[model samples]
Target chain A: MARVARGDRAAFAEVFRHFAPRVKAYLVKSGAVPALAEDCMQDVMATVWRKAAQFDPARASLAAWIFTIARNRRIDLLRRERRPEAEDLAWGPQAAPEAAEALALQQDAARLARALSDLPEAQRQVIVQAYFGDLSHAQIAARTGLPLGTIKSRTKLALDRLRHAMGRE
Target chain B: MTPRPAPRHHPDAALLMAHAAGTLPEAFSLVVATHVSLCDTCRVELAAHEETGGALLEMMAEGGSGRHEAAMDQDGVLEKVLERAQALPEAAPPAPPAPGTDLPEPLAAYVGGGMDAIPWRRVGGGIRQAVLETGPDASARLLYIPGGRAVPDHGHRGLELTLVLSGAFSDSEDRFGPGDLELATPELEHTPVAEPGAPCICLAATDAPLRFTGLLPRLAQRLMGI
Candidate 1:
């Protein structure tokens, strides 16, 4: 990311190679046609390169940050509206996150991946649909046999665990 | 940064997750963005949700859950993206918001400035409002109430999020001060009255039009577009 921010095409190309396919898959799952997804995927990668300076590893992982960009682009294309973003918290020089903290966050991310895969197939499917499929909570409940309360509790439990892992709880 | 008390109420986990996933409607997103701007606790929670999204994206990539590999021409797409990138200048860092603005950045962008800049229209009683332009899926508005004045009792058909930007308001539930968010679902109906102090200013978003119980308020709702 630092290299990309410095306008290194090599670094940007490496990121594109790794994430382009995944972003395409996400768009497809969200109901974009393959051709549309491919076009949008290109736009998303271009954005990743252009917005590299805004990427803060302390606040989000590269994959997470890219996910947000792709998500925002999808909303613009599909919904025809810009999604409102939260105000940027002012980060002073003295407030730079510790190297150890960033490392811990990455490790927790790995744990979260493992935890997600370990979830029951039904639970995981609903979660995947919620994010990539663009289904609302109510829609997810209605589509699946699971009750609304069950779906909410399942996601809530995952969020609680993530908060604990992030050391925010 | 001035230290304000953390918000006592927040959007539920589902709403935060939707926002992180970028699936929330524009009106709801506005409320969430403005609330998260003021509340660090919800900011951390939102980050957690985004992290979850990151993990899911990684998992999908590793698992190759879709047929994208068969259909996508990776090298061809990369060439196109590189071409586009060459023409595009890198984005500059966002400038800091003007000092002493009463509204958060997202809301301020919608309002064009702070409290003084709002083009409030009278919505009857001592309350005024300015409906913000969002997508058809939902609506967002800024509301101003004189100190101790009461907004009409209303119920929501869908979700309604009220975020206090300045001063305070009290409903049947509790007092909502600056940065505090109150989420009203269809099941709850209450009248919110501004607390005695400065006039209360709030940014409110509702997925469905509010259902006012009073006959006169219902007529006002038609004319006022509330």
Candidate 2:
């Protein structure tokens, strides 16, 4: 953060190297078209560069802050793109075909892999379906026949548990 | 000093865990921000989650080539971005920010709906409240009350999301500054007081009325406890 605050372009690039692909992959899984996801990724990095001095180590880890930025960008694009309701269902289940590109997310990859692998079948299913499969809580509820809120709550619990377990206590 | 225990209404380990894992919904994300505004335990836990996220990303890169059979430019992006940053004009003059605010760009984009200008309804004594419609759905709306003013002690049967946009508030855990996300489940109970010096302002969303728990709380719930 200090380096970034000092206008360290190299430092900013390192941050991008760490998070951009993962953020992009995340957007793709969340229903963004591959191109749009890439665009958001770039925007998030730009924001990171512009706001690096604002990064508070006492309050936020870099990843959390970056991901929050990515999440916000995702939301902004979703708001701006003006997709049809017919495309909503189409959005889910459309994973990025660039499996080769999924290879780009280099930060924290192994821990997440182990965590994803170790997840209980049900939890894993819910999370994969929700994040990567592009399904919403309501959509997951419909597909799985669970109540909408129940699916949401349970999915949330599963993701948290997996992240915690993989990250350790 | 020893850090305080988290507030009762603050989200538990599970919710932060999911948020770190990137599985929580946008609607739910708002509520989680509210509790995190006041809860450090979850915040630290979130750091742990990020560490894990970093580790996970690294491991996948080295060990999971099976997913990518074709030649690819995943590394190319890293090089490209680095080159671009390296080429940026060095040490340009920094721009001065606007006044009375320290919001991030995204929050700045959302700084409207005239929260400061909205008409607040007095749902109960000493409590000012107002609800506005938003895009996420019927459930996606902005609800606000001046912070530090004790709201009626209440719990929700459904998910409730809060994000502190301005001022500050505190419960059992910690004081929440701007940009904090708080999530409350059906089981959690919350009552927050405004921090000294300013009226606490937050953006909140919920689908159901707050269910006042217990007799005293039930009676005082109208006063709006957080």
Candidate 3:
């Protein structure tokens, strides 16, 4: 990312080669059509190239930062296609994480991945739908035929379990 | 010695997850991001969510299709990126906040100059507000209430996020100090009074203009452009 920030074409190409397919695949899994995912992937990679200077390693890891860009761009694309009337799709100013927390988080990435798989099936389902499927609480409830309150509690409990699991590490 | 109490108010898990997933609306995301910046606990939680998102991406990469096409168009993608990068503004990121202001880096950039430079307009009842240009459907503002001042009782037409930056305030919910976020929906209405001892400063956003209860504030709402 730093090299891309310095206008290194080679680094930028390398990044696109590495992340484009993964980002598109992620978008497709999140409900975007293959063509739309590819289109959004192109936009996301372009944004990564343009906003490289704004990427703060102290706040987020390279994978996390690129994932955020991809996720947000795909969401914007989907929202615009679905409801163009109210979707502003403007980039908002985001805050930075403290240095210590950022380091701890990066260090614990593997533990976090493991902990997620350890969550109960019900808890994991709601969380996956919320984060990866981009479903709102109500939407998740409707899709799963669960009550809204149940969905909320499941999500909260899933996060608590994650927190405990990560803290134990 | 024990550490200070954690922030009493926070964005819920769904909101935080939505934020990390980058699916939150622009205005709601602003408040969440600002609060996450200031609150270490939320920052860590956000990181975990981001990591989870990254893991999901990896899972998709292993199982989902389109790798062959991605390889084929990698050069085209890089060219488009290069063209886009050339058109980006050459301006640098905003400088860090100067000493003493409670505004976070993101809010400071939005407000431009320093806190003192904020263009506050009186909205009556000893409360002052400086509306910011967040977007058309939603509005962001900085509210300064003198110690003990009270905002009119109100409910939301959509969603309202009020994040305290300094001092404290209380409504029907609870006491809110710095870094506390009070999320009011259409179902809840309460008059928020600034806690005594110091003035209360908040960065607030609303999807729709507040539904002020008192006839006077309601009558003046148009004049105040709230």
Native contacts, share recovered per candidate: 0.73, 0.12, 0.41
List the global CA lDDT of all models.
Answer: 0.84, 0.56, 0.75
Tens digit per residue, CA lDDT, model 2, A47-126: 77766776655434466567656655665676542111000011235443343433332334445656767777777677
lDDT of 1 by residue, B49-85 (tens): 8888888888765334444554466677677898887
Per-model TM-score (chain A alone): 0.86, 0.62, 0.72
The superposed Cα distance between candidate 2 and the true structure at residue B33, in angstroms, equals 2.0
Q: After superposition, how far is residue A149 of candidate 1 from its true place, in Å?
A: 3.7
Best-to-worst ranking by DockQ: 1, 3, 2
Docking class of 3: acceptable
Candidate 1 positional error at B82, Å: 0.9
Interface RMSD of 1: 1.8
Compared with the true structure, what per-residue lDDT tens digits does model 3 show for residues B1-226?
1123567799877778888876666667778877876677787777778878876665454345555665676787778767765675654663444556445656765777567778999887677889876545467888999999888777788788999988999998899998899988889998999998798999888878888888887876766676
Model 3: per-residue Cα lDDT over A1-169, one tens digit each: 7798897889878887777777877787688888787777777887788788887766566777888877767756776511111111123475554678667757777677778888888998887788777666767888899999998899889888887877843
Q: What lDDT is reached at residue A104 by model 2?
A: 32
Residue by residue across A1-169, what tens digits does model 1's lDDT show? 8899898988887888788888888998898988898789888999898889888777788889999989999999988997899988876556656788788777877777777777777667767888998888788888787788888888777666555645666
Q: Following a full C-alpha superposition, what root-mean-square deviation does model 3 have from the true structure?
A: 6.6
Candidate 3 ranges beyond 4 A from true positions = A1-18, A28-36, A46-59, A72-107, A120-122, A142-145, B1-8, B61-102, B185-187, B208-226
Clashes of 3: 0
User: Over the full model, what C-alpha lDDT does candidate 2 score relative to the true structure?
Assistant: 0.56
